[model samples]
Each structure stands twice: as C-alpha cells, then as structure tokens.
Target: MKCPLCGCEKAHKHGKTSKGGQRYLCPHCKKTFTDTFDTIYYRRHLNTDEVHSILQSHTEGSSLRGISRITQRAYGTVVSLVRAASQKAQIVHNAKVQKIKTKEVIGNEMWSFVEKNKKPVSQKN
Candidate 1:
C-alpha cells in the first residue's frame, strides 16, 4: 500500500496496530500508517458501512439517542460521529462553496407558513 502522507508506493507491511490493523511502512517518507489512515474510519471502531448508516440516519432527522439505539452503539459514539461528519462536511463546504450577492433572500418562517397553509380550489367548481 502507498503512504497516505507521501503517496509513495512500494511500501511494505511493517506490523500490526494495537487493534490488530495491518500497518504499512513507507521507505520514501519513513511514515507508518494503516489502511484507514487520514479517513473518518481511522482509529474508529465503526466500519465504513456503519459510519454511512449513522450519517444517513442523521440526515433523516434521527436523534442522537435514536441513532444509538438503531445502530446499537453508545449515545456518545453517535454524537461524536455526527460531530466529526459535520466538521468534515463544513470543511468541504467552505472549500467548494462560493458567496454571491443576491437581491432578495427567502427566510425560513415565510417558507414554512406558505408550505403549511396552501389554499384549495372550490370542490363544487
């Protein structure tokens, strides 16, 4: 595997981590890392699919406790994962989002009122 820090190939297996993850050593950069290095899964017990499920639940408006119960993980773990995902999303948004001046902006209160109070046509007509 290649080193995450240097992106150098030809790295070889060095040892196993305390958690039994295979570790690779890079000769080019003298850095040691695992398959999950620099990723959200790094040092986390939850796998990628588990992390994805948590994120999906969060997007679906599930509460932290609810997510914990659904995923069979601790409440604190749910919060930590949500926070990490939020931070990562924020970084990506800050990097890729652009600001533009607009003449008018719609507020949430107006949108909610409009959404909940739609008028209906006369049934007889």
Candidate 2:
C-alpha cells in the first residue's frame, strides 16, 4: 500500500516484531510507517485490537485514565488518540450536516444537554 502521508508508492518491509507485526519504511519520506498510519493509533506502537479498544472506549465516553486501565496503555497515548479521533469525527459530522437538505435534520445531544441544564424545571405542588 502507498504511504498516505507522503503519497510514496515505494515502501520496504523493515522487519517483523515479536508480535508478528510488520513495519514499513517509506522511501520517499524516509519515515517509518505501519498499518496504523493515518489512523487513531499511528505512532502509538499498539496492535490493531488494542487500537480498536481505545477508540471504542473513547467513543463510549471513557476517560483517558479509564482507557489506560482497560487497554494497559499510557494515559497520554490514549488522550492523544482520542483527541485526534474526536477532531476527525467532528469534521466529518459537520460536513455531513452541511450536505443535508432543509427537510432532513440530525439531532445531537450538545444542544439538548445545554438547554436542559440551563434552567431548573419548577414542579407545582
């Protein structure tokens, strides 16, 4: 596969790790790449399953520390991946929303949550 970052079509298999993971070196950029490149776990040195777990935890509202305990990864790494993924998701969501016609509306919790918390509801005895 081509290197997405530098669009290099030439890549060499550096070596396989103990986990049977293959590493690639991009000839054009001279940068080490892997299957996780341009993904949430890029540069994190994590396996595909662990990367999926991290993303799942983040999407489910788990904190970085929480994900660290579950995935056995550093909290900083979890935070970094979550932040990048969140930004990417937001961009995709905005683009999708923009493409929707006036007849089609998508509901998100941010607006409802703010409205609900903004004022206290009064109960009549």
Candidate 3:
C-alpha cells in the first residue's frame, strides 16, 4: 500500500516492533508508519481492534481500569479516552441547546460558572 502521508508508492516493510505491529518505510518521503496511520491511535502501539473493544467496553459502563485490563492498555490512557469522549458528548449536547427567551433575558453567568466547577461523578463510584 502507498504511504498515506505523502502518497508515496515506494514503500516497503521495514520490520515489526516489539509489540508485533508492522512497520513500513516510505523511500519517497523517508517516513515510517504502522497500520494505525490516519487514526486517533496512530502513534499508539495498541492494536486497532483492541482499542475499539476498549472503547466499546467504556460505552457499556465498564470501568476505565476494567477496559484497560481487557484491552491491555494503560489505565491512564483508557481513562483519558473515556473522559475525552464524555466531554465531547457534553459539548455536542450543549451545542444543540435552543435559545428560548422566556420572561425576557435572564443573567445566570454566576450559576453557569458554578456548574462549570461542579465535579463530574461517575455512576460506579
């Protein structure tokens, strides 16, 4: 396959990493890549299917450590992904809020600030 970054067709399999991921070298661009290129976990050594399974487990209410154990990923990485996904979901939900000026416009900046500072509690703990 051609190198996705530079569209270089002159590529060859360099070697495999200790994690068993295949590595490729592009002679045209002098760049190295693995199977995870153009993906969220491109630089990560974790398996693509394993990461997807971890994400699925997180979505299904599994703990970050639990997902990490199942997928053989760092606990911190799993937690980071879970938190980032939750924040993205919250942002999307907030973006869809319709502005309805009922009883004239009201100022609630202080309350909003407080809400922002509120700690997010997990259902499991």
Candidate 4:
C-alpha cells in the first residue's frame, strides 16, 4: 500500500491495531499507520459502523444526549464524534474544492447580520 504521509509505495503490513485493524509500516517515513489513519476514525476505538451510525444520527438532528442514548455511547463521546467528523469534513472540502469562480456570494446569516446592524432612520414630521 502507498503511504499517505511519504507517498512511499513499498509499505508493508507491520501489525494489527488493538481494534484488529491492519497496520502498515512506511519504509520511507519509518512510521506505522492504519487504514483509518488521517480519517475521523483514527485512534478511535469505535468501529466503522459505530462511527457511521453516530454521524448518521448527528445528521438527522439528534441531540447530543439523544445520540448518546441511541448509540449507547457517553455524552462526551457523542460530542467528540461530531467534532471529529466536522473537522474531517472540513479537510475533505478544502482538498476537493480547490477553486470557485463566482461574481458574488452571500449567505443567509450575512443578510441577517446586515439587517440587525442597520442604523435607525429618523421619521420626518
């Protein structure tokens, strides 16, 4: 497998992670990494399905406590999962969407901010 960090093509299976994921050793970087490395699931004990379920529930607008109850995970774990997922999504977005050509772009929140900050106009008698 090609090492993501060093782009080395001569990596080999070094070992298995505690969660039974295959580990690879990068000959060039002299580092060990797993399939989940550089992903939201990296260094996390949760399996692929568990992380998927958490993200699915989060996308469904489930509250943190609700997700914790639904996934049978701790409240903190739910929060961390959402946080990690968002960070990974941001990284993927930045990588994939390199350029955008647009004349003008505005968001709903920006309009609200402008409306809220508008100066008051005095009434004419």
Per-prediction TM-score: 0.63, 0.55, 0.49, 0.74
The lowest-lDDT stretch of 10 consecutive residues in candidate 4 is 108-117
TM-score attained by model 1: 0.63
Kindly report which residue pairs in candidate 1 clash with one another: none
lDDT of 3: 0.70
Report the C-alpha lDDT of model 2 over 14-73, residue by residue, as the tens digit.
Answer: 886555667888888888766766666655577678877888766677766788898888
- Model 2 / residue 34 / CA error / Å: 1.3
Off by over 4 Å in 3: 45-50, 62-75, 82-125
Whole-model lDDT per candidate: 0.79, 0.71, 0.70, 0.80
Error of 2 at 49 (Å): 3.7
What is candidate 4's lDDT per residue for 72-112, written digit by digit as tens? 89977877878777778779878997778998987432110
Model 3 agreement with the true structure over 3-107: per-residue lDDT tens digits: 988998888899996777899999998998987676556666555676678768766667666777877778778766655555665687689866865887765
Q: Which residue pairs show backbone clashes in model 4?
A: none
lDDT leader = 4
**Model 1, range 1-125, lDDT digits (tens) per residue?**
87779888889999999988899999999989988886677888998899999888877777677888989999778878777766776688788867957999874321101123468866984
Q: Sorted by TM-score, highest first, which candidate order results?
A: 4, 1, 2, 3
Q: Which residue ranges in model 2 land beyond 4 Å of their true spot? A: 17-20, 61-75, 91-98, 109-125
* lDDT score for residue 70 of model 1: 86
Pairs of residues clashing in candidate 2: none
